[model samples]
Target: MAANFSNSLVRWIDHRLPVFSYLRHAAYDYPTPKNLNYWWNFGSLAGISLAIMIVSGIALAMNYTPHVNHAFDSVERIMRDVNYGWLIRYIHMNGASFFFIVVYIHIFRGVYFGSYKSPRELLWILGVIILLLMMATAFMGYVLPWGQMSFWGATVITNLFSAVPLIGESLVTWLWGGFSIDNPTLNRFFVLHYLFPFIIVSIVLLHIVALHRFGSNNPLGIDIKYPNDTIPFHPYYTIKDAYGLGVFLILFAGVVFFAPNFFGEPDNYIPSNPLSTPLHIVPEWYFLPFYAILRSIPDKLGGVISMFGSIVVLLLLPWLDRSPVRSGHFRGVFKIFFGILLIDIVALGYLGGKPSRGMYVIFSRLATAYYFAYFLVILPVLSKFDSSRLLPKSISTPMPEVNGIE
Candidate 1:
């Protein structure tokens, strides 16, 4: 029986794809430096999280129907009646949060390791594209509940098309498919919500392929040139990556099981009514920083441009940092400037959650300008001449762990 099975497998391979071509590629794969740590695991972890979302989302759609009149109640039924309904809903919801958490860490890892420079620029750019698609998917998912925030949030966001100079009003009307946010808007969002994630998955797979082609960056921000500094990709780093995955999953499970709604808006529970509007309409927590940037300027068009400019600036980052070095690690002036950038983002998020006027507005404009200045002005200027303490090449000891990261 074993002989027969082996013979059949050989025959199948011989009959189908050319066997030698596949085997050679598999066995003698390109060399990957084994020195990579948990930071490298994020690409794999992010891939896993995205898979979970797609699977759970498909399960939900089997039960969910898309109609303005029925959409909200359909979800309520799923939560109340469907088997493992609550579990699936919680997983899908929390999965989005997990996705963002992993991606942000992935991006920061890139920044620290200088993964965004040179040949990997396309990889980083594709990652940003994936991030945008994820945001679009999440935003449309928010609208499906047909809640108070969902209705107004859709209305406000889609209306931004009106900020366009020549065709603004027509664009808004075209988006609405009527005078206001109605059944048409809900229907379109449902179609898009289902579609965008699949695109994100494709982009993510390409991201990994692109990353693997160039290998990965290290904490030292230097490619391994000597045998002493390198290791294999299999055993050494795989174990470390698994450990990180386990810890991240524990936190994810805790949120889904204990505090599923903690990241959500309370106003979303109320049903949407066109005539009655919520006192405050805001986007999700993740989008708050950009939202703050949007409302900072009084002019609608100007605010829209500024809001978009925040993300557009990220594309220029590879070129903007003129330093031969990749990280702020050794750069004295850059470290202080880096901290200010983080604080600036937090300030914007805070202001985004506040009402649209007064001190929040004043503070927002200043932060927005500072945001551009850091990327456009400070980074290039400081990279060239800043003097810093540098450990000698002989200083080869492993660095001390900071907050569990090596």
Candidate 2:
């Protein structure tokens, strides 16, 4: 009866706006690979995280004052005076970290499954664009609190633009709205930070349209040959996505309620003091790997170039990886290198948080070298020689049952 009612309502709505029909066709009735694993859940997880951030951010913004003098006090007032304001603020804060976690996993899954190949290249590129936008949004949002780290972080990052040859100084001045970071910078950052999420949403719609056009890449990295090779996105994958969401929320809630400041810097708790800089100014954890890459270079201009290049290099991934087979499961040699790259990135992230001198600098340089090599040299060479495992004929091919499950 419920199903019939839903159908009837959808039909009635379809006659007007067709919104229900679009949702049903694009979401519920969309054909997805049967062999898609839990890794595929991250895309939906990312979308959920984005929604959480947007909603929590809207609530927090209601009470936020985007000013240099009052910004920090405003945040304190939210925590101490406003109704359940702490909860909203904590969710927004922690949600940023969780958002990146899901996105990184989603990107890694795409790399592993060869989701960027051929028809889906545009889809992958759109994902990278979203990532760059997210980084900018997060960085601007970080500055809104007008805390010590927030002030210095904004100063350090904005100054990087001054590394440009001809227009560097003017660009920095324009960005700062003066000789230094101040009220104008803070106000503009707040405005852009609030605006960028909606921009991300718009691009995400384009990303989804591209995705639906090509369909999903499966674990096997093979084209769907028959109806059995695919399944409706509704019941099967929706349930899986729901389970992933529950687990993700558990972790997010843990951080929000139990370890709210675990990912935050102690320096951020202090109000911005331009005269008294922290001994070592570091960015949020998610930017650490690239931060390490930036400092690894000896020259300032080179470091800035290298830092931006690390992200820009990802744009070339679809072309960099020349392997005939898409899935790392089949490519024996590529899998080993992929693991090494993961370890190298984690090592860089750790080293990024520490003082950038002595052995730390050496290790960071080495890791940074390998990081570029993985994309530029390792993938191109290995693609030609890596031995691959035999794949099943189709996504629907039944394998030996694991324990008694089909």
TM-score of each: 0.89, 0.95
Q: Best lDDT goes to which candidate?
A: 2
Which ten residues in a row are the worst by lDDT in model 2? 397-406
lDDT of 1 by residue, 1-406 (tens): 1222246667566556556433433233434555565777788788889899999999999888788888878888889999988899889988988888798778777766668877778898898888888888988998998989999999889888899999999999897788888888888888999999889888877887787776676665555565556555545556677788899889999999999998888888888888898999989888898999999989999999988788778777788876776545555566778778888988998999999888888999999889999989988897677432342231244544422253
- Residue-level lDDT tens digits of model 2 in 175-226: 9998899999999999999999999999999999999996999888888889
Q: What's the TM for model 1?
A: 0.89
- Can you list the residue pairs that collide in candidate 1? 34-231, 34-232
Task: List where candidate 1 sits over 4 angstroms from the true fold.
Answer: 1-30, 34-37, 386-406
**Model 2 misplacement above 4 A:** 1-9, 386-389, 398-406
